[model samples]
Target: MAEQADHADRADRAGHADRAGHADHPAYPVGLRLHGRRVVVVGGGQVAQRRLPQLIATGAVITLISPSATPSVEAMADAGEIRWEHRRYQDGDLADTWYALIASSDTTANDAASAEAERTRTWCVRADDAEAATAWTPATGRSENVTVAVLTTTSQGRDPRHSAAIRDAIVEGLRDGTLAAPHHRTRAPGVALVGGGPGDPDLITVRGRRLLAEADVVIADRLGPRDLLDELPPHVEVIDAAKIPYGRFMAQEAINQALIEHAKAGKSVVRLKGGDPFVFGRGMEEAQALAAEGIPCTVVPGISSTISVPGAAGIPVTHRGVAHEFTVVSGHVAPEDPRSLVDWEAVARMRGTLVLLMAVDKIGAIAAALIAHGKDPATPVALVQEGTTAAQRRVDATLADVGERAVAEDVRPPAVIVIGDVVAVGPHSAPTTGQDRPGDQQ
Candidate 1:
């Protein structure tokens, strides 16, 4: 009997070697049009739960055969997404089936069903044994109009994690404009006001990145994720709306005219700015300008730095019991500036948190006004400079001495100032020199 068992083990190894040696007969990749066609899944366990959603999406006529199933699979049956036979697999289960997946826990049932699929010349996948299966599933992903599928034809080289990693890489490249397929897509002529998010290229919205990938012309600001510009195709034109070659920034009127002219000339235009286009970004001005010229405009919201910046430095604008409300105010102009629209006195009187953007230069006067109006001079303040970028740092101070700290610490513009007790609630509330903080990656 031991000799017979040794012989069987040798035969099994020989079978595996035979399959591995037939490299020329590798699986030929083809996408099945399973819509309205019969498909059978012989298991309702974890495998079925994971693979059913993609099958149902194909609009195929699916029938699942199993005595029991996971709750999620049962839910799919209850929702009429699939027909569940609540019985053990029978010999004729694969009859008239276009494709079959044999994944039942019972080895005997799986073998029978796989044999039926083979006898009927139907393509089948055996989860228990890939070598015995006639077909294999590829790691798939969709980016816009593109569908990516990665497969390893050789059984010896098969690795699901490797295939999934390749799929993710390709999809991410397609979404981020690194892999531009301009020849395959028809470009539409219009203006898209896309907020590029704080300073990180990855922070940009997927929609914003997709629009950028399809753009014929991009009018970019200096503040946002400028690194993305280096990824644009050579045929695409990038206009520096923030600065010109002559040491002067382009005027708002000129920028508006640029958008209108490019769009009218039958080019896809993207006005990529930092932060949300609607939050003090003059996005409405651009939208109104486009409307006046009858140009179509699409606004894509972005992650605003007003909240994200402080959060990156471990500050929450609103903490339970610390502050119930937070107000975002632009500090481009000093509190005493004639053109300033913010009522500093009224703002100081509010008991909630105060978040000031573009306020590094004017924080001193602003702090003094807040103190005089009724805010506590000793209220904790945090200045996050170049927030969410490689150069990000935090400066801790109070309303009474933030002005001096700003100058002494060489704090620059593009800093977010946070005031109120919420500043003291964060873990990074401890005092630190103006240097790169932890987790301040690009």
Candidate 2:
């Protein structure tokens, strides 16, 4: 038994040694110059078409060899963007090429080309068989004056599918200008998990602005303010991670995985969110995930709907002489189990403020529950929808009447509800167009 144990240990050590050896193999280096370099592309379909433009963009002198080329490739050939060789790849096609790309649908042909490139000591990328290639192109991205290249080597054994998805996300970020220019003095790329400030572009912070200007990739949610994105440079990559309200979305696990992957690729990534990342933004969860992977992350706070919505409508959550304390709650809960985690009775007795987020749909039921739990129905409630934006509207009424008033005012999602004496202190006594109030446009 002891001999068997020794043999098992030896086998494990040998396996580890083999992996280390594979890691040491030279394939492709990051940020390699391809300008004016001879690069041969094999194939003529969409895959090859997709790979060609990026190569051309990098100033690679491209020679495309295929029986037929896609119209886009044909156009590029006509435009003198690339040299189109009207034939299939031959054994010696890569002999004179400095670098080769195999984007053909035939895996067999891709493998053969990769093998040829290797034998000829030429750099080669097998789009269909990335593992068999001498090197692989990462999802390439560029933003304004910034350029980001993500390379996944087979030596690391990272799954190509996950790597490709991550690369696509990075490319999207680069096209969106969310990835800022790299700081020359500091080699370390900074990360900012910015809250997009409750769906209003103007509400984003100055620090957020600075970080956006410097980021190489912006990983933003669907609900994030669109105007903020509009300001980004045209080349900046913007990736939409299936964020939809009351609909299916890209799983949180997928988003977390993408974040870690991009950061690992050494790009300055911004996990842009809809509200304060700490306030139900899941910022802490993402931060923990990043920290676990040994990636540095920093939180850039934003105007959370919890406070901003009420404040925008001239309602202070905490009034010095009136309500001295405040509590924020999530209104998004199962109907049958609405009071599962919260002590409604305790909240009723606290004599403080209650700010409800995502509670518009459940406002009536919540008001009834609070009243049933001994809270006064006469408690003033202020609902501000689309807060701090040009489209903002305010609804002011007692807790007993606020829900009905919200319906009358046509208040929508991204609204904030403040329940306390602070609602009574506001100048406006009824629902009014947000434009009527001073400093409300912000």
Candidate 3:
């Protein structure tokens, strides 16, 4: 009898603490089916701009009442996604409205519109005052087909940042298969051309990582974030599709044939390449080849080393008052080679930054051509090798001696060559030995 009495007392104390933690009654959460219903948004500022897309997605007949709106809101109105009254809120705007959002800059107008919503017995959300709002918008995110919504309130009040953090955690977990729910599995058979970003596994995009997590087969390149393959499930077939330059390598035609065969066999295929597939990565060629075979292809863009590698080495491709234009070109062929399509003379005529990829082997001839075509012989140059990876390093030199410097440092392929005054513009312009770490110099 005494133990039962103690349990009852403890339960009463827990209930009391729960009630004391909230300043107002706990809000009951519900998903409103708002399709074909009248929804009015008062104001057209950042708050309204942020909320409009979700409201628009509900298929509600939305009417936006404001004298002025941000450019994005104006675009929505122009696109006919919503009807814009081009006027301020009046008393009767909430009549027959099923739901309303009050986010105008004018507090008096917000108060008036919210009061009208109250009188009409319609639910309304107030961006200015959550205490007075009849409805609260939850922090929402979508992962795969699952929608995660979180609404959290502290002893003080609504903690939106906390709610957002929770939402992000849930969404990331679901996306990467960390949550491991049955409904979140991906079984679709198609090809996804994913850009693995510039050598850093962490730099790969969320979409790319999610696709990798779902892939039954991953055809990987030698240059991209190869570490990502180690994280795949044991059942996933990781094909070594490395295209080594001037060595044992798989031909492009063979790679295309392999992708077709695997996809035709009903396995989900991901052609993971280094950097963006479209940016000189021969991604469009594979895309075209897949199209010929009637295979569905999804291209996910990655961060290209053309810009990111230089950035990783503390060099902005373009700086204010320094360089207005930065040109990126492939330097696999010497400038004098008939097979080369790049107009090296025109490139040298421009007074801007020049970024070269696959040019380590031909740097001597390329630099001589640039100097001969009016480019300054003493123009600064920095080569970032294995950029964004642990082995990344920077080799600095001038255009006149970059060829000699490349030989002295023994710079190899897979290095990005940045040429121009912009290399000398940053705090990291100091020369370094080849052993300098990327984080230390970049």
lDDT of each candidate versus the true structure: 0.88, 0.76, 0.89
Global lDDT for candidate 3?
0.89
Where does model 3 exceed 4 Å of error? 1-28, 33-36, 44-46, 57-59, 66-88, 104-112, 152-158, 181-186, 427-442
What's the TM-score of each model vs. the native?
Answer: 0.74, 0.53, 0.83
- Model 1: per-residue Cα lDDT over 224-324, one tens digit each: 78988987789889998884323579898999999999999999999999989998788999999999999999999999998999899888887655566
Best by lDDT: 3
Worst 10 residues of 1 by lDDT: 433-442
* Per-residue C-alpha lDDT of model 2 across residues 1-442, encoded as one tens digit per residue: 9999898888768745654576666455666588988889999899878877778988988889888988998999999999999887878888778888788876777778877876676877777755566566765555435566665654566665676677777655554445444456754654679887877677777567656756667888876777777776666566666466687787888888888887788777888888788887788888999889888998888888787777777887865456667999888762348355776667778788999887888888788888888888999888887787788888788979877987887777877888887788766554334223454332
- Candidate 1 has a TM-score of 0.74
Top candidate on TM-score is 3
lDDT of each residue in 283-352, candidate 3, tens digit only: 9999999999999999999999999999999999986556778999999999999999999989999888
**In candidate 3, how many Å is residue 354 off?**
1.3
Better of 1 and 2 by lDDT: 1
Q: Considering TM-score, which of the candidate structures 1 and 3 is the better prediction for this target?
A: 3
RMSD of 3: 9.3
Clashes of each: 0, 17, 1
Clashing pairs in 1: none
